[model samples]
Target: MGGEYELNFSCMLKPYKRVLLKLSGEALMGNLGYGIDPGVVEGIAGEIAEVVALGVQVAVVVGGGNIFRGVKASASGMDRATADYIGMIATVMNSLTLQDSLERNGVQTRVQTAIAMQEVAEPYIRRRAIRHLEKGRVVIFGAGSGNPFFTTDTTAALRAAEIDAEVIFKATKVDGVYDADPQLNPNAKRYQSLTYGHVLAQDLRVMDSTAIALCKENNIPILVFDLTVRGNIRRAVIGESIGTLVGGFCEVS
Candidate 1:
């Protein structure tokens, strides 16, 4: 039995060697209404560890919606730039928490922030981040481009391009991109595949326009999948076709 397990494991082939995982801060919330949930974070870390064991270079871009949402704050009367900066800081916090969970799972990780926070994390250095991934360490990117008015989605696309990742796995609550909100529309259709032009034209909201544009320009495919489903990360890395794929092709099912 042990021999068979080892043989099968060794024969497993992943589709992409290097990839970026975009995780929303809300994912860490799990069943909670706010804040990070330890159980949820640990579960995600375990799955990431499994993928890393497969020799895939992983980079993560985490959002800060759970702790703080800049957009909402701004709409409530706060200065837009100030709210966004606070949101960026919130992302750093989430990144550190994720790094801790990942390390506890025996996966080496580095937290790099766009804003200067050398005391807690390394500054975002593209070459250094790539080098860490090459060395089998997971690199977590925090802060949204170190600028205001940009979502973490854009940061993921930007960082993925900088690190030369082959694909971007966007882990979301929904399983895939839908023509309408599945939560609201019972007949909402999920897209199996999509093209950059279609996504841009239809404004599917898979990611922000800036993010989609960046991915399109860099030719990096973005796979939108449900993070709540355990093992989905590994499934994505192995090309199991569990999500909506956005790239140069278009298909619907």
Candidate 2:
């Protein structure tokens, strides 16, 4: 627990006014074995609050890997589609938890689900979600595109395209995409930037192929960074040199 660091926006290069942040359910687990960790959620909310205060509109898509994974269940002999629906529900749970933490941090938030759960959240509406962001509310998209065989990463890309997000901020356990597993190879090379074609051709595994292809098609930039760092989210938003930037137009410098 440390005090929030004040970002000097004057020194920062903010290339994105609006961003879609993709958070994996496992990111909320902290040091626990499973499920949401309140402290971790709050810390993430705090970082988000900082970015919101900086006038960066943020929309989030949370994955359900911590509670359940659809693919894993399918491997265990469960019906694929049914297990995927269950996984979507798990994402909704994570979204609610994150929304609660963000609200507690005094950040205005809206939770929109792909599957209509009117009692708990607003059904995903692209127009309404954009309106919420324009009004400075952080909108969270849940339920993974309301379909089986798709992922929250795909949801993030789809929503970003729908909402006209300037970039996709993919927060993960690792700092950035590397040529080899950094954990195993200490000398693994981390790319500061990568082309979508390179990622696809090399099979970087930074994101699902479908998700990567979707982003490549839409020409949306993806910034893959470590969520464990307290201020990394804000850093990513402000365009600090922290993570691997993929599939964006680079101006001649």
- Tens digit of lDDT per residue, candidate 1, span 1-253? 1111111222222478999999999999999999999999999999999999999999999999999999999999999999999999999999999999999999999999989998999999988998999999999999989999999999999999999998899999999888889889999888777777778888889899999999988888888899988888988898786877777432222
lDDT by residue for model 2 (82-122), tens: 99999999999999999999999889999999999999999
TM-scores, each model vs. reference: 0.92, 0.93
Predicted model with the maximum TM-score: 2
Give the clashing residue pairs of candidate 2, or none: none
Instruction: Tell me the deviation in Å of residue 144 in model 1.
Output: 1.6
Which lDDT value does model 1 have at 11?
A: 23
Q: In candidate 1, which residue pairs get closer than 3 Å at backbone N, Cα or C atoms, i.e. clash? A: none
Off by over 4 Å in 1: 1-14, 249-253
Look at candidate 1 and tell me the lDDT of residue 12.
25
